[model samples]
Target: GFGWPVIEAQASSCPVICSSNGPLPEVAGDGALMAPAEEEEELARLLIQAIHSFSTRSELIERGLANVKRFIPEKITDAYIQLYTKLGS
Candidate 1:
């Protein structure tokens, strides 16, 4: 029902540590640290790593923000216009 929070977190340059279920993986793309769904141990381990590993977390956050920005209205509109022009040709 909602995936915007994931995107927003990424946009704020925060790496997401999420349960590996639902549409979170899809929405997070390569910009998240996912743990096995319903597996507390795995989730805990990944979360710890995400929090403790500064470099990896920073990279994910940066990439995620960049990826999310690509879906912004202005950028999407520009892309649509380009596609339409190409199709019209």
Candidate 2:
């Protein structure tokens, strides 16, 4: 399942470094730096990069804010309703 922490981090104005496995990459969009699942070295490198650079961090925060727009509660509910209606039709 897609987790809520990704959006929460963005909502709090924090950049995220998470795994690209499963829905994470799709969910994160361009908002996060994603490492392959179980790749500790890559994840560590991304963390260091995010931590040491101001511009990159800022860019991620900006993109994260933009990405989270798709997941607003009303928009999500409407999408589900549309899907269900289409299926019923």
Candidate 3:
């Protein structure tokens, strides 16, 4: 399941780092730094990279803010309405 933490971080303008498994990648989109769930070393490298690179952090923050807009109330409701309409047809 997609969790609120990612959304919260994005909306708060914090750069996110999440595992590449499950719905995390979908929720994070291109707004996060992702490594395979079991790849601790890779995750560490990504964390270090993110810490060292101001531009990377800035880009992630911008993209995360944009990605979170997809979850706004109106959009979620509209998406559900669309799906229901499609299913009923």
The clash count for each model shown is: 0, 0, 0
- What TM-score would every model get versus the actual structure? 0.76, 0.90, 0.94
State the weakest 10-residue window (summed lDDT) of model 1: 62-71
lDDT of 3 at 52: 96
Give every collision pair in model 3: none
lDDT leaderboard ranking: 3, 2, 1
Please write out the lDDT profile of model 1 over residues 43-79, one tens digit for every residue. Answer: 8898888878889888888879877976689998999
lDDT of 2 at 8: 87
Instruction: Report the candidate with higher TM-score, 1 versus 2.
Output: 2
lDDT of each: 0.84, 0.93, 0.93
Residue 83, candidate 1: alpha-carbon lDDT: 100
Off by over 4 Å in 3: none
| Model 2: per-residue Cα lDDT over 9-68, one tens digit each | 988889999998988888888999998978999999999999999999999999999999
